[model samples]
Target chain A: MTVKELAEKMNLKIFCGETNLDRTIEGCYVSDLLSDVMGNAKSGMAWITLQTHQNVAAIASLKDLSCIILVKGFEPEEDTLQHAVEEEIPVLGTSQQTFETAGQVYQLIC
Target chain B: MVFEYPVQGGDFTNAGTVSSKVKKMMRQLGVDAGVIKRTIVALYEAEVNIVAHAYKGVITVQLDSDKIYIKLDDEGPGIPDINQAMQRGYSTASPEVREMGFGAGMGLPNIKANSDVLEVHSVVGKGTTVEITNNF
Candidate 1:
């Protein structure tokens, strides 16, 4: 699935990287733990997490993830947004709960 | 080939700035993508630990043709059990840190996975030192 589709599925607001919406995704990992996500997540996948921190962006950058979706309508911190912008990463926010968002993303990818 | 950064624990906002800079430098230097990815991942994990758990600290990076050496030292509450801390999913971070998507007990483990050599030394109630070397 592409990021644009995800935004539509979750009814989220995109804060950055609109040009890459057509980018294809292979898998999804739902975790608030930066380490496990970084250590195990496959590249070019969408990452769903409730935790909103700059470290999330750092991990996303290292892992080369396609995007970061903040579930449950949680807003990102200033640092998180700034890092995402600087890295040209696509960070999105959703009003759906973690479970629902994961299920939606799973259906799209799987 | 040598880079050093002062890691401030004052704000979680700046935790990954040092590692980010190092990552940019690697890109400019045209280092191998795989090597740069590994180094930055390990460096960022260590930097986050220092800021979240340490009172204050510094991150030093030493790079050469063969390896990248990163050293982090912080004057915060030290780890009491190195073995326990090394275990994956064994985190002692507070809920606040966990809310920030960290403290999943994967910092040290991730560092170990990304770097070839990792040595940790912590004096309980005093400070902690983490040294990691990534072979390119």
Candidate 2:
């Protein structure tokens, strides 16, 4: 499913990078640790995390992640949103926690 | 080609800038996708190390047809036990750094796992230098 489709299905808030919401999601990686995401996330996965910093956007870009889902109603920081906008990588949000979001996403994609 | 980028200590905002640039260059050069991914992962971890641990550092990248070589030289409190630091879950990062989702002790291991060759040289009081090479 594409990022837009997932957002719609999950009722996720699109914080930035609306232009690239059409990017395809190949898988999902749920991690709050930056190094874990950097080391293990696949190129096209949707990353679920509580990290709201600008480096979150940087890691998403470096790993070529399709989108970032901030869990538990968490939101991206201002600079994080700005970086996501500049990189055209969607920074998404949801009111659900990581486990619920991951389960739903897994059901949708898998 | 050769390129150099400077990294400042405690500069979380710009941590992955160099790796992003190098990834772009590799993609433009038509490097294999897998190779590019591994190189970027390794390079990014090394880059973050400088920002997390060192006062200042410089990354020198040499890109060739067969491989990409990256050397990070930093001025900071060097590692006294490279072996211990290489182990998983052996981070010495400050609480502030950990709060930012870094310093989980996975940085060097991640770098080693992604790179073909990983070399670390350091002196306790002075600094450290990390060398990473990945074959294309």
Candidate 3:
């Protein structure tokens, strides 16, 4: 599924990178740890996390993740949104907790 | 080609600036996506180390047809035990750093996993130097 499709299916909010919603999604990874995402997240995966910092965008870009999903209704910082726009990687949001959001994403992608 | 980028310690605001630039450079040079991915992962980890632990550091990158060599030399309190530091889940990052989702003790291991050749040398009172090589 594409990022837009996943967002629609999961009921996620697209805060930025609307231009990149067509990017393909191959998998899902849920983590707040930057290094863990860096070391393990695969290309084209949707990263579900509560990390709202700008560095999360860096990790998503570096690892080629498709999108970032902020759980628990957390909005990204201003810098984070800016980086998301710059990198053309979609920053998404959901009101559900990590486990629920991740499960939904997992079911959708897998 | 050779390039140098300086890193400031505790500069979380610009942690991945150097790596981002270098990644763009590598892409412009037509580096393979897989090789670039590995190289950037290793380089970014090293760059974050400078920001996390050192007072300051310089990242020197040398790119050639067959390989890319990166060296990071920092001035700060160095690692006393390279072996322990290499182990996963062993981090000395401040609480503030950890709160930012870094310093999980996986940085060096990730570097080692991604680089073709990884060399780390340090002196406790002086600083640390990390050299990473990734072949094209």
CA deviation > 4 Å runs, candidate 3: none
Cα TM-score per model: 0.89, 0.98, 0.98
All candidates in order of lDDT, best leading: 2, 3, 1
| Residue range B1-136, candidate 1, lDDT tens digits | 6777887774677777888788888777778888888887788889989888888898888878777788998899999999999998898898988776778888888889888899999999999999998877
What candidate 1 gets wrong by more than 4 Å, as runs, is A9-11
- Candidate 3, residues A4-89, lDDT tens digits: the string is 99889888899999989999999888888899999899999989999999999998988889999999999999998998899998
In the range B1-136, model 3's lDDT, one tens digit per residue, is: 9999889999888999999998999999999999999999999999999999999999999999989999999999999999999999999999999999999999999999999999999998899999999999
Residue range B1-136, candidate 2, lDDT tens digits: 9999999999998999999999999999999999999999999999999999999999999999999999999999999999999999999999999999999999999999999999999999899999999998
Candidate 2 Cα outliers beyond 4 Å, as residue runs: none
* Chain B TM (all candidates): 0.95, 0.99, 0.99
Model 3, first chain, TM-score of 0.97
Relative to the true structure, candidate 3 has a C-alpha RMSD (angstroms) of 0.8
User: What are the candidates' individual DockQ scores?
Assistant: 0.64, 0.95, 0.83
Checking candidate 2 for backbone clashes, the offending pairs are none
Q: Which 10-residue window of candidate 3 chain A scores lowest in summed lDDT? A: A101-110
True contacts kept of 3: 0.74
